[model samples]
Target: MVEANVIYVLVAREFKKFVRDKSRLISTLVRPLIWLFLVGGGMSRLVTPELGMSYMKFIFPGILGMTILFSSIFSSLSIIWDKEFGMMKEILVAPVSRFSVVIGKALSGTLISVIQTVIILMLFPFLGIKMGLLSICYAVAIAVLLSFCISSLGIIIATFYDSFESFSVIMNFIIMPMFFLSGAMYPVNKLPHVLQVITRINPLTYGVDALKHVLLGDSGIVDFPIVTDISVLAVSSLLFVAAAGFLFERKK
Candidate 1:
């Protein structure tokens, strides 16, 4: 009962914070839409790579993965802020277990990311992309998994950083590199050998691959099995969340 209450309270607070941020609410959808319309559309004309899928089709799921990845990682900044403001210490002293606190935060971030994903999907057909009704279920499953995995990663990062400013610097240093290398905007095959190797290690690469297969029904040269991708994400998320809990308890 206490663990449940902890999760419920954390999620409610996180949702309220999201609602209060009007600019963030708008920019979440606006920035991705602009990229899809202006940048992705223009680049489609120039790059005629015969990947058995239209440029827009290929990039759509990548952008979707980008949404979850960015939202989850950025969510860690909230944790850093809470720490700086001494709210984290107050929460730490609550009756709930540290595991509950960490996992609750991860789940809250995952929910927020999935909401952003729905907005992104609504704009897909507007960009001349079509997906079957069944694909929506697949997309949701993939998004939720990606959200869990990414949010767990955020918790891991939150354990390391003490302030939002330091976290922002690390975000720029870490998140963008991961995004670009994840094949979110382009094919991994076209990248250099080192980058290709890096992509293979990136959890987001598997996510984009899995989502592309499910959403766009297109997987390029990459033949990532759905089971393998899902298993990797599930395992990684569990491990990361456990590590985050351990780190947080030690910090306390």
Candidate 2:
């Protein structure tokens, strides 16, 4: 009961901080919107009808992944900010278990990512992607799972960097490769053998593929099994949360 209360307090604190930051909220929406409209629009011209879906529709899952990826990972920046301002130390010295701290942070990041992704999801009608109730529910579930995995991964990464600058550099290096290689923008099967292997190994690829399956249904390009994708994401989320907890406990 005490641990649960600790988790709730920490999560509530994070949400309050997120809500107070208007600029951060807007910036989070803008990047995914730009990619969905501007970049997806331009690419739609060159992409052939042979692909069976418009580029906009094709990249929808990828854009969702991008939204979740950026939101989840950047959420960790709060840790660096808190540390710089000594807020983290105050929390660290509190009576809560390190596992509670990690879980609370991960859940908070997941909630933020899901909120951002839902905003993107609302633009689907404008983007020409048709989704039903079941699809929307599945997408939300997948987003929640993926957000947890990515957020936990972010927290683990955050434990290593006390400075925002260094954290930003590492995030940039990690985010792009993960996003591009996730087969979010293109069909994974069509990629070269080596690239296909790389995408297969990337956890984000499964998340994107799962989203594609749920959102686009039978029209989705990626034929990756939904069951497999969900299993991998669930396992990955557990692993990442455990890793973050372990790291947080050892932090100075």
Candidate 3:
């Protein structure tokens, strides 16, 4: 079969799994809402107006980043599931290239993350976060790039573990630090020199910075140039996919 068909099959299978899990679907739709309200509500008073907006508004882009972060990364858990249940073995031994398998998994995560991001975007109006159509379009564009980049990263990580239990343990150690360091909740410049270097290296930091550029506009909170964010994510996605493909091929 064609690689396109492989990607389609994998994407559809994941989509079906996603849809059938009502709890996950609800949680995915609700997680950002909780953060925006529960966390953003309390933090707003403590936050300063020098941010050029309310704290909730200031963190809207970050909330979007959070949505993509969790959704894209966890979607790769399907690989561990497939591996344990014997499905992944058949897939790896198939005539298709391992790159096709990796692309299939990456696209599955990307699709789910993008859907969750759009759901979060729909809340912008309700939150008094007025954005034009082009801004929304731009935000979605970056979400796609970020989602693919993150999903590729997740795939690379998933290749290392064959069990869901082990993967979950490792994810806990990595995910929170990645979010906190990504400049999602605070400015990177305010961080110490060590943290500043770490955030610069995080793909999500560039992604959130890109979201700030497109969403916050002249909020003056952006770190890197928009081109830098896109370049890093784009290049990283390719390299990560290549790495995941190589890893998957080696497992054969």
Candidate 4:
């Protein structure tokens, strides 16, 4: 089969799996809403607006990034289950290259993440967050980048786990730290020196910053630089996807 056909088959299979799980679809939107209402609302009064942004606008992109990040990472967990059930072996035995398999999974996860992003986007207007056509386009681009990055991260981590329980523990340890350190809920400058270094290293921080810059208008969040943040994330996504392809191919 042609490479494009292989990609289509892989994506279609994954999409079917995604659609069959009603809870997955429901929770994808619900998780972000919880964070927006429970966490954002609870802490809104505490924030002093030091980041040159309003509380609602500042958190808007962060929550969006958070939704994409979790959705992608959790989506990757399916690989472990596939491995245990011998579904991964079946796919590996196919004529398509292993790299195609990894790319297919990542792209499918990204597509689902994008759908969740759209669902969450409807709430923005309700919250009084406004965006022009150009801004909306940029926001979609940022979402695509974030989904690719996090989905690639998930695939890389999946290569090391043999069981779902182990994967969950590993994800909890890594994902929570990344979420907090990535300036998802607060500014990096507010972090201590040690944490500042970690935040700088976390790829999610760049993604969040890029999303914030696109969604909240150029005038917002003037304190933290955005150009370099975007650069790092763009580079990281390519590198991560490359690495995931390599690792997964080796497994085959």
Candidate 5:
């Protein structure tokens, strides 16, 4: 119960901070909207999807993944901020277990990411994509799973950096490759043999694929099986969370 409260407080605190940061909220929201319209519009001209959906419609799911990807991963930047101000030291010395701290931090980021994803989700109809209530629920579920996975990965990476400048450099190295290689903009199979393999290995690829399965539905584009998407995300999330907890323990 105490550990649960730890997570609860962490989540509450993070969400409240997010809500108060108006510019942060708008910038994060705006990026995805820009990508969907400006970038997606341009790419649609050159890249007609064989998936039976318009290119804009096809990439909508990927845009949501992009929202979650950026929000989820950067949400862990809270850790560096905390560490820089010495707040993390206080948290680390608390009576709660290190695993509890890991869970707390991970859940906070996941919750924020999902909130951002949901905000982007409301734009679907404008793109001529209709989502039933069931589909929305499924998308939220996958967002939660995917967000947790990315947040765990982020926390792990943040542990290795003590400052924002160094962290931004490494994140730039990581974020773009992960986004591009995840097949967010194109079908994975169209890539060269090596890239196809790398895309498959990307966790974001599975999340976006799962979103495609849920949102697009029976379009028969035939990426990974939905079962494979869910299974990979679930297993990878566990591994990521456990690894993050271990690192938190060792670091403190």
Candidate 6:
């Protein structure tokens, strides 16, 4: 009960911070929009129908992944800010278990990422991506799981960095490569043998593939099984959360 209360308080605090940041909310939405309208639009011209669908529709899932990826990682920056402002020490010295704090932060980040992805989901009608009710629900489920995995990863990354500048550098270096290797903008199988191996190893690849499977139906573009994607995400989320908790517990 005590742990639950601790988690609840911490999660609520994170949500309050998110709500009060109007500029952050707008920027999050704007970034994905630019990718969808400008980048996707330009690429659509060169992408042939033989690719199975329009480039805009094909990249929708990837944009969703991008939304979660950026939001989850940036949301975790709050941890560093807290540490710098001395708020983290206060929380760390509290009576609550470190595990609860980790869980709270992960949940808070997941919630924020999921919310951002849902806003992108709302753009499906505009993009002509037709998903049934069941498919939409499945996409949301996958988004929540992916958000959790990414959020936990952010926490793990945050544990090692104290400054936004340093963290941003690491985040960009890691996040950009993860997005490109994720098969979000292209089919994984079409890549070279070495790139295929790399994409398979990237956790975000599974999330994007899973999203494509749900949103695109049995389209030949996504070669991975949905179960495999979900299983990978579930295992990754657990591992990241465990790592974050271990690091948080050891922090002075």
Candidate 2 lDDT over 122-155, as tens digits, reads 8888767788888899899999999999999989
Model 6 lDDT tens row, 1-252: 138887888889878978998998999999999998899999999995767678999999999999999998878768998988899989988888988998888889889999989989989988778878888899999999998898889889889888777865875678888888899888888889998999988889999999988888787888688899999999989999999999988945
Which candidate would rank higher by lDDT, 2 or 5?
5
Steric clashes per prediction: 0, 0, 0, 0, 0, 0
Model 6, residue 178: displacement in angstroms? 0.9
- Candidate 6 wrongly placed segments (more than 4 Å): none
Q: Please provide TM-scores, in order, for all candidate models, with all chains considered together.
A: 0.93, 0.94, 0.95, 0.92, 0.95, 0.95
Clashing pairs in model 3, backbone N/Cα/C closer than 3 A: none
- Write out the backbone clash pairs for model 2: none
Relative to the true structure, candidate 5 reaches a TM of 0.95
**TM value for model 3:** 0.95
- The candidate, 1 or 5, that scores higher on lDDT is 5
Worst 10 residues of 1 by lDDT: 214-223
Q: What is the lDDT of residue 22 in candidate 1?
A: 83
- Give a tens-digit lDDT track for model 1, residues 89-200: 8898788798889888999999999999888987767656677878888888889988888888888888887877685577677788888898878888889998899998
Candidate 2, run of 10 with poorest lDDT = 163-172
Candidate 5 lDDT score at position 84: 89
For model 6, what is the alpha-carbon lDDT of residue 41? 96
- Model 6 lDDT, full chain set: 0.88
lDDT of each: 0.82, 0.86, 0.88, 0.80, 0.88, 0.88
Q: Judged by lDDT against the true structure, how good is candidate 2?
A: 0.86
lDDT of 4 at 144: 86
lDDT of 3 at 247: 83
